[model samples]
Target chain A: MTTERVDDATTLTDDERRTLAAIADRLIPAAHGMPSAADVVTDERLRFALNARPDLAEPLRQALRPELGPDLQARLDTLGADEPATLYALQLVIVGAYYTDAGVRDGIGYPGQVAITVRSWEYPQYLEDGLIDAVLARGPVWRDPATGTRARTDNAPNTYAERFGGTPPEGDTHGHDRA
Target chain B: MASEPADVLIIGAGASGAVVALRLAEAGFKVTCLEQGEWLNRADYPGNKLDWELKARKDWATSPNIRGLASDYPIVEDDTPVSPLMYNAVGGSTIIFAGAWPRALPSDFRVRSLDGIADDWPIDYFELLPYFYRTDKQFGISGLPGDPAYPPDTEDAPMPPLPIGAAGLKVARGMTKLGWHWWPEFNSINSTNYDGRRPCVQRSTCQSGCNEGAKASTDLTHWPKAIGLGATLITGARVSRIEHNDKALATGATWIDRDGAEHFQPAKVVVLAANAIGTPRLLLLSGLGNSSGLVGKRLMMHPFANVAGLFEEPLMSWAGQFGDLIESLEFYETDEKRGFVRGARWGLAPTGGPINTALPSRAGEQAWGPDHHLHVRSHLGHGANWGLFAEDLPDEANHITLSDTVTDASGIPAPEVHYRMSDNSRRMLDFHIERAKESMDAAGAYKIEVDRLMRYSGWHLLGTARMGDDPKTSVVDRWNRSHDVKNLYVVDGSCFVTSSGVNPTSTIVAIALRAADHMVETRFEQQVPA
Candidate 1:
């Protein structure tokens, strides 16, 4: 995404901010026990998303121009039908900022993605209760290409050294075999 | 005035190219690779950062037409239903792949022989079987063995299977309840510490890239090892076309750098390991290896769709390896009774974070006003999607051609795609979509949503330059040598004889390793430029 044509002039004027705020509220209103768009669509959050996608800055600015009328819902409908990219730009900025809001994420009881240290692998609880016993019992679904029948996978020689007539390298016999 | 030629020259550094470079270099051959894109730093992927979701919509988008980077080439895909998605980096499209590591089933090789439709592969599943074993360890694939989906693996995964988290558990329960086939999917992502890479923490941003380097993009899996064995890789060197001698043997390639400077790379043998579209485009541009007029024919991208189940329980669906939690091949084989010649494969994948729930980066449009929050709250962390990838059969009518009007930044003509979804693919997807919905319903979901025929789901680019015994129909032979040009090989997905109902990376690299091994076994007999 590092393109030469990216425009970095992102200092928004007061009028541009008002234009974006107006569109943001209509795109994501206050509902579903969540905070309003005003709480999430801050100038700072929008800028962060904008910086990550610098190529969108000029289009986003153009979308926030004085061309949009005050009838916000109707304006959105018009943009959705006529200028879809502009509407999409505004929507992307709003949704991006809304998720970044710490309060909103906390209120929703969702912590952002974080790395967890994996301990020794163990089968989860559900799998322990015969969940996949049926699958294991249904052996060897793959067909033999030569005969066009389900191959005898259980009784078949499982390695090159076995059926295909070659010796496997020393001590090699599992998914755990590292080259 | 030119430097001494290397033993082998590879025109890409993606999955197949990286593997060939590694294998040939290990065999003590002097190898050089030209990559259009530079190596990506694993840490720079948006998985760990704030505003990470937004990156998926813009910068990290899969379709190169959307990314608009200097490293990317524009594709004229207006005529096609599916876009040809690829990455031009050191690891290539593996940079953005989901790392689902399912090997092509045995039946997948003989589509023509078994089904009597497409042409049979000159080489069958057994030829590449040993290489798959070696390549699986090379990439550190994680999975449980003894699934009825395929022939049994001789050994267990080098590491343990990835934890099938809450979302996977629900989907697995549903599939098992129906007495259908489902198994913990084989993934190139690390489940435990293996191959010197950290285990996956399941951040679920796999499609964007693996920040923890848990997922095996070839840059991590093969390039470093290949370079260690003395394969010289030149980044920012976009190969314009394959160069050949008057004797019709490939010499090397003429490449253009980032600054628009041109240079000729000399080699005794040249390998075109670019993806299906890129390889065919390069060949078409150079006017080589198309004497059969099949260089850019028979394009096949898996006709892809998604079915999401919304449950009451907070599945925390956004918090795991998003690609291969569980896969079902219950309907993988063909059954003409279902009104289709072939079938589809299904994999359970976690839906993304809030922004993705509100407006999926690839899905078109979003709900606005009051309904926007409703859409967000209902799906944000409560859903798991079953990706339905139907096997798209090759049709000669569907193909890629060089665009007369379009070109890349370096002014190389962009490849134009002409793919039409077949009646078989359409019926296959329709039937699978309903079955997938039924599977979701079995999982105790309150509601199900279907995203049918998503345009951006065109990751599996294949079959444009297929391999066969017939020189009149195929681009490459069973050994992957171009029928028209000796010393020139195509070892990527381009040489796939048939499009299998699984991810192509494992098969691609495995076949490349087999080809590289063949080259080493018969090095003294290989033809080169005069």
Candidate 2:
């Protein structure tokens, strides 16, 4: 089902549109207790809103098109009927993909039913789980052993696993128990 | 010369000043208070939605939010730095603050000693506990008696807690699920009836001034009691300079009344309760505190940022005590791993009015458009917004000086606030963001859009004229008496040693109460040499 309305609004290219949808969903992914981020139509609505603010819009569009490729644009252009409905429906699917994508969800720390304040301090065990494999993803407690200081680590667990080439010791690999 | 000389002269009949006047007058000392702002009454408050922009329906000059010595108060500026001063009216900024009256945690009084950040206050919480109790009874605070969260649960609050709304429920559920601590916010507002004031109607416009007289701004709280004691209040008299002897002992002060006519009043003692920014600027500009040279240093602003969550249900933040609930103090303790010296308290702040909710950064264009309207109708109720008020460390760089360009109608240089977050503050913000995001997600928010961190300019601006052990490093001694002026005293947030991450009103009032008693004892009973 799609929204059945038409409005004369600034439009985003399919590539840019998809990227926006992906990021929005990554920030708030779908889960068991809540509606999927895609269901909210945050991306499509944001695009139409940003159309008036070109300074921000142009930068956003430029960032998205590289990942979207030409084929999706051609398909979107041919299938479009009512502008809002077509754009919105397209957004729903892309956002759905963004929410379901495990890697992206993990990168943004999209834990289901998050209690932000408690989680503000990371569970020592979660770091062991390699869930905190990235810097930006690390909460303040994730201290860098070498510097005797705090810094953000990388979110790419596979890259980390590759570099280390071995499973981390039991307590170091999964921070689930600590969480 | 014909003007009568009083035993004590108090400038600005506001919160701290009025309290001092009452205490002094009750002690049989003749007291006169001169206020530069209009003597607005309880009926003057205009409770409206437009208050978000206009700052509680106040005219910029007459408005307590905008009035200050360095800003609205008259001065001839020629590139010299000045600061924004507060109101010179009866009951000063207390006339315009959101009646969030949380007492300073005991750690607040001893932060420098406990955390090794700022200097220790002249007195500790234990010394001021009796005053805190007295003032709480006087103001009729609304809170529960015991929670084991922090301390001396003296008695049940004069009134019951305000009813928590949808926003409160969402925050409480989220916090409970996460095993975080929670409690009702202690407000200097009458939830039921106390001191002849009515209960709150939950108009949720307390910041714009409450017409119901439920929220205890001094106009409704302290003034009536103070006035009943035969104290005379002179409004719209802007204090300009402190007149003293060659010894720098304060004997009198000069001020310009509302008509721009100058009046000099003599007194045996003078009290400066003109708040943090104004108090120091007055001392510095009047050339009365040069011996200490610490009038405008160690300036601290409890810079706060809002971290909100968009929940799955309407939190109708506009409906009640701006969210009656607050979360645990589990994180209120500092840890070395967080790379911060102090801790922050998280609370549920409901900030979703038409203007604030529709921030260009947050709600975006969908705010007014058809989609935006739908989003608001659907998700605005779902607005489960919470915020983190972290304590910013005392950074010498974050000082309030005179602006180079802008000046108010009075020609005083606008207060040029130089504020930049320390690495510690940045780390605190990062931690707060992570927590805010987690709460939003935990509260079943379908989508969460968090605003990036920005400098919070207003929240108990303190420490410009900090109290300390040494004269050179401090403006006022521990008793809030100017080190240079033996008889002049500053009894406001200006005397704060550090800006704790909570509302400073209670602490300020407590300290002022203590100082008043001390002054009485010292002047009449015995003399302690500085």
Compared with the true structure, what per-residue lDDT tens digits does model 2 show for residues B399-483? Answer: 6565566654443454555656577866886787787777666667677666545332354668878887788778888888878
* Per-residue lDDT of A133 in model 1: 61
| Regions of candidate 1 where Cα sits further than 4 Å from its true position | A3-10, A152-179, B360-365
Please report, in order, the local distance difference test score of every candidate based on alpha carbons: 0.82, 0.58
Q: Which ten residues in a row have the lowest lDDT in candidate 2 chain B?
A: B49-58
* Local distance difference test, candidate 1: 0.82
Chain A TM-score values for every predicted structure, listed in order: 0.73, 0.28
TM-score of 1: 0.94
Quickly count the clashes in candidate 1.
7
RMSD of 1: 4.3
